[model samples]
Target: MKRLIGAGLAVVLVPVLLLSMLVAVLFGSEDEAQAAPPGGQPGVVCTTAPASGSGGSAGSTTGQDVAGFSGDQLDNAAVIVGQGKALGVPERGWVVAVATAMQESTLRTLNYGDTMANGQMSSSRGLFQQLDAWGPLADRLDPAKSAAMFYTGGQAGQPGLLDIPGWEQLPVTVAAQRVQQSETPDAYAKWEQPANQVVGAVEGRTCTTTPAAGAAGGTSISLPSNPRAETVINRALSQLGVTYSWGGGDANGPTLGIHDGGVADAHGDYAKVGFDCSGLALYAYAGIGVAVPHQTQAIWAAFPHLTDRTTLQPGDLLLYSSNGAANGIHHVGIYLGDDRMVEAPQSGDVVKISSGIWGGNRGAEFIGAVRPGA
Candidate 1:
């Protein structure tokens, strides 16, 4: 009788003790909870902006104007900005988030998509038109939860701005695409100006600034002792935000872009007015008193080829080609030492610092490096 009583007591006591400890561990102290980051709550803290005028108009009280949106739309935009602030995204990120929401759902917390043939709504919903892949319907419909998910991605493995390398320096549209992966990647660009305006209106500050040049990932390449190489790198860096065009730049400078009549034309890149890959390289080399051709194959032919990548020096042209043949070279970029290179990547893109010369869609046949004037 005594043994059975002791066993029963032990069973009840052990569980009770375990439960007490678990509760303490989970809750922690009041100070610890307070110290936790925002968004730790079940939902983000949302505050309605003060209305303007005697009529209590929905426009911002901060004196900046947010026209064209109703009270509900402005409120949803505020939520996105709030979530972005909670997540520690920069001011530029706030602009991006608001712009993305503006484009995706026009700041509406949608509950359904266009009706399908079966009379059911499409899977996409919420302020971002997020599909079921983003999260559960309840979470998606909650403006705060959806905004957090958009900024940090979600329980699923969808890409977000935090996941993208050098997202800060990327064009607004490109950064948004890194997360959204929309069918029409360039569509987001149109929303950038309005987004900046809305963010400025909500935050009560100017927000028309572009991302600062050389503000992306830190400079990977160490400056070489060669003066000419330094000039080439600096020249390339000067054109950081210039948009990519099929046949845009030259030895003189950036020229008005001409239509490629190819995939580039489909993106409305004919009027972009910037540099192509080889054209950028041509302009950079020209800055150093070296005249290089505006064609990749011709540029490769103009210089002595370095058979080994280890022998490559700053200002060398890193050439990529479909095949490892002389005539096969199609893309050219100025190497900036280390693994970094400066190139104007594709139409509807821009001149930017790429971490590696050959990767992704650019096949691995590195036709080798060309040292101009070596």
Candidate 2:
């Protein structure tokens, strides 16, 4: 019999776009989830991994045949799901975790760091983008090893994350920081609730935060006033066919468009309207007051841990590999179910919705979707 991993979850709202453009957009140079390694005090290390194979899992039931996600995304999802099951994390948590990853490093373990210099890039190390400056490599490339480090800090003092303040009711960012010690703790707080909501819907499960037994109480991370509003998405849609620019969106930076898609002239700051990969992501979410980081790598750093891609939903990000590196996913977009996505296409292409995989373009590729406000 197929085991019901974590908790059975429900499906979330999925989007449907007509033309989708997913090229190298919003690509950032940084390592996300930089945390202290394990070997500290021992906590509740749930030895049993959660059971991922559901009897009849819902949502994107098409399995590997789904046209949206690429082979890499599917493979990554399978691995992540297996990992979540091994850890016995609720299915909802697993899905939300993947969404968090989507918002972060696009699920590609990083081998470099942010900040390019003198026409040279730094060769940092590890999964979830760890910097070598922190220390030498100690099982850095291994996702499990990195995950262990992340959990060591993220799950410190709390069994099943019960000790973290507002974790259960917060966004993926908040819940993530509870486990992952980050420079910007507040940043992760915002993604907590959305991540949970997305995970719950994808896994067909329900998570609660009423407190277990004698657990202390904390304030829930309040969600945006209207999560379902199409203001941001709509604005992004309106600004299709924009050119790409690098370093367009940083935290509290200019407001033209910093991500990949959309159309804009090149100039200093917000003089014109252009965006790179991360720029577009920030612009779209900013329409709704989300205030996402300008750097794509920072997005990964400031959120909960993510798992597989089968748990993706609309408004979620779909990051894919531009170059065929083992785990090098360089492109990103907003997921619109049925293998469709809404994003700013590459040069010569307008902002439009298209197939997640084949948006009628030779270079168009589909990776995995990241649920930001899941």
Error of 2 at 73 (Å): 2.8
Clashing pairs in model 1, backbone N/Cα/C closer than 3 A: none
Per-residue CA lDDT of model 2 for 100-185, tens digit only, reads 44334444455554444466554444433444433356644565554444333321232223335434333343355444333443
Question: What is candidate 2's TM-score against the reference?
Answer: 0.33
Residue 262 C-alpha lDDT in model 1: 83
**TM-score per candidate, chains pooled:** 0.47, 0.33
lDDT of 1 by residue, 173-208 (tens): 656766776654544555665666556556544344
Candidate 1's TM-score reads: 0.47
Please give the range of 10 consecutive residues that has the lowest summed lDDT in model 1: 13-22
Highest TM-score: which candidate? 1
- What candidate 1 gets wrong by more than 4 Å, as runs, is 1-67, 114-121, 212-374
Q: How far is candidate 1 from the true structure (C-alpha RMSD, Å)?
A: 21.7
Candidate 2 positional error at 110, Å: 2.8
Estimate every model's Cα lDDT from 0 to 1: 0.61, 0.40
